[model samples]
Target: MPVSTVSIPVGQWFTDDSGRWWFDSGSLALDFAYTGAIRVTVAPETLHAPDDLTGWMRERFPMPVGVARSRDLFDAVSLRDAIGRLALAAGRGEELRAADIDLVNLYAATPDIPPTLGGGSRQAGRSVQTVGQALSTIARDAVDCFGPANDGRVRICAGGCGIVYLDTSRAASRRWCSMQRCGNRAKVRAHRARKSGKVALTAA
Candidate 1:
């Protein structure tokens, strides 16, 4: 199974410039990486202000995160980029940069949000005291996913989407990030090409 700090909803989808919905990349770190342009063809800049960061936190985590500050936003963007680069490198079998590794380690060193019980429900939730804690949690998840034992499972979508994801299939043969997004598009294009070729041959 892919490493994750929380349950990934099957319908958790994000829209891009083309209005196509794309799902999570199977981990919180990779999801964060997707909030902005990394290696992906369509980049979405969702973290523009402190409120943007907090809103994203609320969407991703079941618990409430502390109010984000301007400084926190800056740090979050930096960490996000570093995580993105690391994930793409891992997926492409490229060498991980030392600076990016150090940046991730620095954020991961911070204390993470502690789990709390009794939040109007029996389910456990996290108590995030600060934005740094929330970021630390994401950085730690990146560490786990990019580690030697799990890095091999990282894969870049083959449909030219440029997104990276964990290949958790039984045979580890997953080629696209999401079937509804890239996979179906690829199938349609192949079918069109075949039909065009057949028409040309009949005319000739």
Candidate 2:
């Protein structure tokens, strides 16, 4: 079954140690991947408890999902790690691991929230009622993103943020995850470097 590609809004934010909030990856699966520590070494695990998972789902999905249990948290973290690994491989044009593929397939095979019609208004109907369904939806999106349909559009953030995002730009030249975050930082660093070089030339 072909999963319809869904565009997740760019509202989900993560705060780094410097207290700066960073935008999430554009896709649902990639956003879910952002919940875990991708490449940074310190403070890796973000989904610490069941409530954490519940909070994450509530923030992303339009409707409220049931409270996640311990088992749900465990499974969610496992799926998140698998998606991160597979996404990195897809972005780098490397062969994906069999275990990661099988795990994502297992979750994708589960039932997911379906779009529904109500009150004569068409809603995306992401009314996720359970943790399992939410995970399934994410896994299905991952399959769409990393599968042959992707055409190698996935890319890791060049700014060293370790975010794996689908390159949706027209030119496919996007390097940073968010312009306000990494892009702005890069610009500031370049400016400072130029200023320092000018100072050195004056001293010489």
Candidate 3:
């Protein structure tokens, strides 16, 4: 059976320590082709432009691929460090936390969701070795080298696709920076899934 499509807003992203836009990862449709593919035919950059958030709500969008890492492409320490401290705390190794390590952002370009190839259940996901030291370590090192606060937050400003970290403290209650979209979406998905059997795995 084919899975139905569910489209949402695109989120913003940040430039890693190396200064490359890792662009938001959650809502980005990696497979968004006109033929109805999970991966989108359009370029990721089309919806996302690093630090260039001139778009607006539902207008251009600023959502992540899914609700997972939002920027799982960080393959370096500097870039990892660039991820907010809360992100680092949540991220496993230099990547997203154990919960979202294997999840690929599944949000779509349109208002539809494509079939997830591997399915959304990440119960089997295993922890992977990080690049160099942990993100926290790298962040600390950078702070020391820079001799000041470079500010652990990245700037991603896509009106609707953006997330503003309300609190980046050490608490575990830090879900999405905003509750209107990401957080609300999660709640809705869980409810819908519980009410129906069609939902196998959801990254909304």
Q: Give the winner by lDDT.
A: 1
User: For residues 148-185, could you state the per-residue lDDT of candidate 3 as single tens digits?
Assistant: 23233322222223332322234424455345444666
The list of candidate 1 runs beyond 4 A from truth reads: 1-12, 37-41, 117-128, 193-204
* Model 2: worst 10 consecutive residues (lDDT sum): 4-13
Give the lDDT ranking, best first: 1, 2, 3
Query: Would you list the clashing residue pairs of candidate 2?
Result: none
For model 1, state the Cα shift of residue 43 in Å.
2.4
TM-score order, best first, reads: 1, 2, 3
The 10 consecutive residues of candidate 1 with the worst lDDT sum are 2-11
What C-alpha lDDT do the candidate models reach, one value each?
0.79, 0.78, 0.29
Q: Which digits, one per residue and each the tens of the lDDT, describe model 1 over residues 1-204? A: 333344433225666665768575767788788778475556678799999999988777767778899999999999999998888889889999999999988998888776554656655664445788889888888887787767578888888878788766777778888888889899999999999999999999
**What ranges in model 2 sit over 4 Å off?**
1-11, 41-43, 120-128, 191-204
**Candidate 3 residue-wise lDDT at 57:** 19
Which pairs, if any, clash in model 1? none
Total backbone collisions for each predicted model:
0, 0, 35
